[model samples]
Target: MVLNDRIGSARFVTKTNATTLDPFKATEQGYLGVIVNGAPQFETLVEKVHNLRSVFDVRNLRKLSEVVIIYGYQDDPEYMYDAAISHHADGIIYAGTGAGSVSVRSEAGIRKAEEAGIIVIRSSRTGNGVVPVDKGLPGLVADSLNPAKARILLMTALTQTKNPELIQHYFRTY
Candidate 1:
């Protein structure tokens, strides 16, 4: 079975056994489709698809910017966020406790990062649950994305644009 999803301008495909396919759940989760019965030819699938660029297309590839992820803890020091700035990172994903709630000191560091033109993304350290937008926060929210996924998206987004609003839109859309 082939499961497909799009991220930014990239299209990705995942191949799995047909017996493991769950059609309803896959579609509900926004997967493109599933092919059952027998193993499908991989080359035929890619060759027939039009307009979509190959994942290995070097010409269309953009060099990803540096993104750091900091795990927030109770009374944590601001060193992690500060280090990202010192290292000249393009973005920081804060994996905060609970629904992406950062420590006071972490928030202070995030403020400094924002001032230095680095984009900050608030994501939950918890395995699941959405992190909503908090206007009082210094940077953008990562929605339902975990810290790792948020970091990947942020790196790609930063390569395209530095606009906070546009980056936030990418979080919402992708």
Candidate 2:
């Protein structure tokens, strides 16, 4: 329930105390670079998350954010999990390598983050596998949605509840 995530990434975001909310300024944060593994690319969907009213409102915060787009294959990924960790980000949308299988090294990193109380969601990096939500993995929570969708799902989930069980229920029904 504690997002003790050590990767204080938000600290790196530019200061907004001195700036005003502008769509152009908001766009400057750079695309969020969503690394989609599958789930046919849809223009409608892209606009849905990209043009989100809440995300747009973030620009008004001293913690403005950007949304970017990225693509990958089930075989090889280009992003390292730790960067997601070290960045001290608000959420980690991990697309697990297989069947939500995590590497030993990565698991430690994730476990450390989770123990630190970081919000960790196990997602299918394979793009097709279902994350084991009911099995009750000791250290983490199931993503419930495929990776691409998981980010948005988790983001909204955070606004309402940070409890693991509550998050799990949100995954099941939200």
Candidate 3:
């Protein structure tokens, strides 16, 4: 099962050969176990639970930076450019179509944003895969993160540092 899953489904059976692994017992002992066909089998579980702990566990708990996501298309990227240059957005995630390939107009606007000291992240609208770092691009790659999620992370990162390299590191790590 996926670790991020919030819910799960299982079946219970009643028979002479049926096996039972009590969750309550597992909680009491601080160890979960699994049994099959009335026999004791698997008994390996982590001793300590992993947790997010607190908001402080993640970066930039003191402040939340403003970030905007813009799509790459035929339309002018003036809105995004304005947000970064005029309205003073801390970061921008460009959701480029097809392998994070930006349109000429959007790329030009993004370059201007970068020049104006805005942190730009190249993300994909296609939903999956890494946005490869291109020397011709003005901003850092968003790695495997999509546009919306990249905006979220970039906001947090901007709160911590304005350095593009540091923000890029945050993208790769987090």
TM-score for each predicted model, relative to the true structure: 0.70, 0.50, 0.66
Better of 2 and 3 by lDDT: 3
| Model 1, C-alpha of 4: deviation from truth (Å) | 14
Among all windows of 10 consecutive residues in model 1, the one with the lowest summed lDDT is: 7-16
Q: Runs in model 3 with CA error above 4 Å?
A: 1-63
Q: Which candidate is the best by lDDT?
A: 1
Candidate 2 lDDT over 7-45, as tens digits, reads 111211222245554212111222222324532322222
Q: Please provide, for model 3 over 13-65, each residue's C-alpha lDDT reduced to its tens digit, 9 standing for 90 to 100.
A: 11112355422121112223344554444355434332465221554366678
Tell me the tens digit of each residue's lDDT in model 1 across 1-174. 243322111222222235764321321124333344544333223323323342223356657889999999999999888899999999999999999997889999999999999999999987557789988877899987778888888887876789999999878766
lDDT of residue 164 for candidate 1: 95
Q: Give the Cα-based TM-score of candidate 3 against the true structure.
A: 0.66
Every candidate's lDDT: 0.74, 0.47, 0.67
What is the clash count of model 1? Answer: 0
Q: Which model, 1 or 3, shows the larger TM-score?
A: 1
Global fold similarity of model 2 (TM-score): 0.50
